[model samples]
Target: MEEQEIYLLITRYLQKETTTEENEILADWITDSVDNEQTFEEIKLTWQHTEQIKLEESTIALARLKNRINHQQDNKAKTKKLVPFKWNAVAASVAIIGLFLVGLFYLLKPNDSVPTTYSVLKTRAGEIKTITLIDGTKVSVGPKSVLRYPSVFNNSERNVSLDGEAYFEVSKNPHKPFKVNTGDLTVNVLGTHFNVNASRNQILTTVSLLEGKVEVNLNSDKDDAYVLKPGQELTFNRANQRVFQRNLDSLNTLGWMTRTLNLSNDKLSDAAVKIENMYGVKLIFADQPTADTRIYAQFNGDSIEDVLTIICASGNLEYKKQGNKIYLNAK
Candidate 1:
């Protein structure tokens, strides 16, 4: 079993609720030899440290974070920024606090059991699932995406890993920050609405901020940070973790997690890929040259087959679905 699985089993054993097989495995594991006992001791020690961290400041920190935000709100109410782009310090601060809220719950456990977990939520091609995280962050995972998060976030930070794409509506807390770690770079936010695209095959990872604010920081040197405002998107090149900032259509970017695909002047190929992913099918473009043609339409509640049929007919393209694979050719 993986380290995380074994850790989970150990945690269950500590609760005295392990199953027969689990108990046997735990016994075999804990008493396999001197080394096994030593390892268990180490994990148990780590679990205890995690608990201590959680208890050390979860309540006080949460309250303080909330107060900071309220104080900021009071300031905003008194003096609204005349120029939106000049200084977004308040927005940045709030987003950070929002992230703090996500991190706070992770540190404290309602059940008081600090479980060791590295389990991930994943979907097949053409599948989508909405997840309510331990910290109450709402994540809409897209097709072929995976999310690896701790069973409970421990004190200090709220972090999760991404392998594909998802949209996050993070809960806010100022004392703790919410961070999403892709293989290449880390996306940190105070309490922001954002979309992350981190497919492994991608040459770069993308984060589009919808509302509030976010900070893009390199995992290597977190102190060096890049703050992002609403309507701004950050893309990090995988090879070097280079962060690039650009403008984006916030609504269009946030649409994915909501199962709403909005394409205005979208290329045929681009639209095809999204449809295929949403429905878990293949879309092969015949007459490859015609595939680059752009079409403008909003596909929120459309079936893949019907969407492809309509788009193809409009473009004078023909398509056939064989199992999950689709072959498209121009007439």
Candidate 2:
């Protein structure tokens, strides 16, 4: 392609005018020589500026056209476009370039003009997940739990919201306090590891600290804070917005966060309810009083049968299953 034709191609590109073949020819010539590249840039930039000027001119033309149409309608005998508009229409070819640059910069800018970003990670019954947060905190969410945070954190603060249970290996950035919003309670830490259990209508949203100090607020909106030391657990009462710190075995409390399950001789009915809710399944008692039967066990990625088989053998309980549902009856 001649260098002269390349100049003509410049106008066409600004108006989005070139066919594929023409554009390829233009691209080839521009990339072929250093002089051609500079010449192409100058031409393109000129076209952009000229295109903006033409756009403004066209907008004015359009406004004038509309006014003339209205005038003709108001005076029926007055003809619209009595003098045909002598628009060369090449103004847009001159004006749109600068606008394109401004728009490009706006899209590529830092923070990208988006104020806040939020994410929710939830697991249902029998399902679990491992997730990483914006602040570089790594989490392992238990079945029937959810963890949420922004896709990106701002320089001012780092925040997350959660429902259910999760083990957090929080990333350390002293200036930005990592905060977790779990319904009525808020867990804050400078840089630490912890586990939290918060769910809807639950009496207590328990928080177990593994490392570092975590400020647990029963009423997140209130000034009151309960600072939990390593190896201490705080049960934030969702009902009354009270925090209770207890001396507990960190291993047992943090058990569910791992691949194991630990239940300290909890009631059979309570355990059943927990299992059903965690897995989103139904546990029907074939015998009404049987559900209240007492049981004790630890689960570590055990199959439903492994847990049931032991429970049945130990408690003299009989069980039956049909489809995804299970029934328990007294033996």
Candidate 3:
């Protein structure tokens, strides 16, 4: 299709007024070549970013085109005969829209030259992995977790999406703020050490700051933002869209980084959850009382059997281990 025809069809498509035939024509044109598809995407992106064209802007644009036409008239006397007056009017309209589109393209085009491409890193059950991001940030991913990030940091910001638990020691870069998006909540920081637990099985997503400051922005309500200092923690309950902050022990918050499990008078049921997550085991309680029993202990790099043995001995309970499952019962 001619450039003018393509722009017209693009305008119709943007306005959602394209006919079936026009749609097919545009689709075929876009599918014919990669360049065509990229052009179409650029046009679409520009159109979405630009505000609705105002009548005053269009009129001013047309007036500017008229002055250009008058200037061309001065040169017309020295050259061949100009196109017909009707053709000039039609050309003027197209020029106005074209100028508006060109201005929008330049005004709204992304400043960064880097193309955005994403890479996903995931860990299965009973697995833990560490990754160094392009920006030199170190991330320790816990079991059953996935992190999706851009292959390269953009000029504007560094962003990554996470699901499950991870410890991040972000490299210091104040100019490019780093952001972690966990669907329901977004954590923003410059250079900071933080632990985020956003496991799908958990009711609340927790963000614990180890060093530096970070801002937690709620997805449910964009206006809600909480700033967390070092040793402070923020919890976001997605169900009720409630967010609260509290002081947290830095050791407890950062323990998972070193495979250190600490339970300070934690309920048996809560500890069970932590054990299950840490060791990727299924803990079944024989009765509600056994599950509700409380215990206090700390385990550093302990095997699953040792941890369970300690828990059972402290609670006067018996635990039978089978493969990846453990059964806890009152002895």
lDDT of 2 by residue, 1-331 (tens): 4423455566566556666566556655644544455445544433334433444554544455446546654664633223322234323434333323222222223464434546788888767788755334678887788887775565556788888888888766666688888877888887888988888747778888888899977555668778888888988666675667887686566655443545665567777756665545667886657877777667776767787787776567888877768888887
lDDT of 1 by residue, 1-331 (tens): 5444565566655455566556556645553444445456544434445444444454465565446446655576544321222123423444322322233444333555555667689998777888765444678898899999875565457889999999998866565589998876788876778899889976778889888998887767778888888889888887875778889876567665555677677788877766766777777776767788666666676777777777776677777888878887777
- Per-candidate TM-score against the hidden true structure: 0.61, 0.63, 0.64
Estimate the TM-score for candidate 3. Answer: 0.64
Query: 5-56, model 3: which lDDT tens digit per residue?
Result: 6766776766667765566577566545544555565556445434655545
Report the alpha-carbon TM-score of model 1 versus the true structure.
0.61
State the C-alpha lDDT per candidate.
Answer: 0.68, 0.65, 0.75
lDDT of 2: 0.65
Comparing 1 with 2 on lDDT, the higher-scoring candidate is: 1
How many steric overlaps are in each model, in order?
16, 17, 0
When sorted by TM-score, best at the front, the candidate numbers are 3, 2, 1
Query: For this target, which candidate reaches the highest TM-score against the unseen true structure?
Result: 3
Better TM-score candidate (1, 3): 3
What overall lDDT, based on C-alpha atoms, would model 1 receive against the true structure?
Answer: 0.68
Of the pair 2 and 3, which is ahead by TM-score? 3
Name the runs in model 3 displaced over 4 angstroms.
1-115
Model 2, total clashes: 17
